[model samples]
Target: MQACELNVIKYILFVFNLIFAISGIGLIVAGACVLSEVGEFSHFIEGRLLAPPVVLIIVGCIVFLVASLGCYGAIRESYTMLMAYAVCLLIILIAELSIGIAAAVYKGDFDSAMKNIMKDSLHSYNESRTDRLAWDNIQSKLKCCGVTGPKDWPSKTRPLSCCHPIREGAAPPQEFHCQDAIEGDQILYNDGCFDELKMKAESSANVLMGVGIGIAFVEVVGILLACWLASAIKNKE
Candidate 1:
């Protein structure tokens, strides 16, 4: 490879590294947002489902650090640093690919796994205060009653959060309200929490999967660039 071509490759890698670094920062911010939104219930969720965001934050930081090395190597035209960058890129590529494949495979069992987790959470609703609050929040946010339905509750009484707030000029129920409602007419939210939560989880997983695949493609390009640049430098030397 000619010196001029090597110089061009060096600049290309530098630009690519800059873009990759920005992507890493974006992932970190997104992961932090997810963690913040989930709040208390995050602990109760399945590890497989909860882990990706955290992993993204950690991996994103590592990628950012590695991108710096690539940028510096490209600027300095240092064979040693470029070689090290290539090795790091290879490792990141493998890790990202493994995570992407695992995520895809895990989607198959997501529904069953989510159902079991929600059931367990419901069973512990009264036993653990944390679980109880988490369930209440889930019920309120999703506007759902119980795991399967209102019947899941032994008393057949729905939490206050399950009830939609009374609209202006609408008189409150004369007799039974959401809390004591046993019949379908009185129940504020009859739908189960599992389905709503499952749908949300599936949607989130799809988005993450898409993002992972996109990142993997970029990593592949990075890996190829790093290897090619390293080879060209070696040949020139």
Candidate 2:
């Protein structure tokens, strides 16, 4: 090729490198935001901060690395480097497309399962809290039943409200009244509630894993495309 032609090719490569760099930086920034739970730049549609999974972090780093190679490859006019980056990118792209399809099929199932788990956890928390409150009420009510109208109580049987000659001596009597009914409730089932919470946590974990995997795939494909295109310039020359 003529000197002028080579210069033109270099210029073209430079332009491509600039474009790829910009795109790579954008993807890396987005991934970082998601991983760190930073700004709303990469949040779920629900307007909530969503942390990206470890897979996404890996993918983002790979994209930035390949993109950096693209810049260096253009500067050095190194076909081998470009090709290496292209191959790496292509592998990731293929994986992303394949795994993304699989994930798409099973993602809904995972989401549904997670939702059920969360619902169960919430129910458990509510039920447990209620039962605990009831248990306390029952204990208080028993104390009330133990106390008589200060007339029929035995000497040893003391009322919860008033104990004459307190340890502190001459302290005012404290009144204790139970609000629970005498007999109209079943025992609290806190175990089931706790179990549900565990399930909910597990489900959330699965969702995050899936999201990270998916994002990793995207970054792979994007980087591969840029690298492959950059290498093609050499073949054309």
Candidate 3:
């Protein structure tokens, strides 16, 4: 390549590195948001479900490291730095793609996993304090009763969280008590939480997938640019 052409490529790589850095920040932010969003109801989600977001976060950090190094190599016209950047970016690309695929696979099974975990949480609601709090938080936020319906709770102690939000802190009124009264007479089991919580989980998972793909795209481009620049530097040398 001509000197002018190599200089043009160098400048392009430099600017691309800046954008790549910003993208790294974006990845970390998006990943954390998704992680926290789904993590709130972690009790109902299998531990493995958190892997996608966490891995994305790591990918973002790696992007920062290699991307900054890429800028150094590209701007200084250093063949060695450019080669190193290309190699690191190639590795990062593979990891990002792997995590993206894992996320896609996990998303397909997220619903059933959540449902099973929720059922287990429900069963432990009476025994585990953490489970009780999780159930209460989810029920109150989503305005849901048991996993399927109000009948899913223990008959004697359904708890007040399953009731209306307005009556959440207050004692249940005579007209809408949560006791083992006829279904028509009580207000606790009005809705099931499975659909609502599952939707939230699925949305978060989708975001994770999108971010993963985005990071992967950036890495691929970075790898290409680094390799091209490295070759140009070598030819010039």
Best by lDDT: 3
Give the better candidate number (1 or 3) by lDDT.
Answer: 3
> Which residue pairs does candidate 2 place in steric collision?
none
Candidate 1 residue-wise lDDT at 157: 42
- How many residue pairs clash in all the candidates, one count each? 0, 0, 0
lDDT of 2 by residue, 1-237 (tens): 554555565566566556555554655555554444322111111112232233444655666676677667756767777677667767656655565466557655644554454334333433576433432332232222221122222343322322222346655434331112122212111122223322433454455555545545554554554455454556566
Off by over 4 Å in 3: 106-110, 167-176, 180-186
Model 2 CA deviation exceeding 4 Å by range? 1-3, 34-54, 126-237
In angstroms, the error of model 2 at 40 is 12
**CA RMSD of all predictions:** 2.5, 14.8, 2.8
Return the candidate ranking by TM-score, descending: 3, 1, 2
The number of clashing residue pairs in model 1 is 0
Q: Which pairs of residues collide in model 3?
A: none
lDDT of 1 at 191: 80
**Candidate achieving higher TM-score, 1 or 2:** 1
Cα lDDT tens digits, model 3, 1-237, are 389989999999999999999999898998899999889888887888877788778888988887899889888999988988888888888777776676667666866887888888888888999999999999998888888778887767787787765555776354336655445444565778898887887788788777777777777888888888888888888
Sort all candidates by lDDT, best to worst: 3, 1, 2
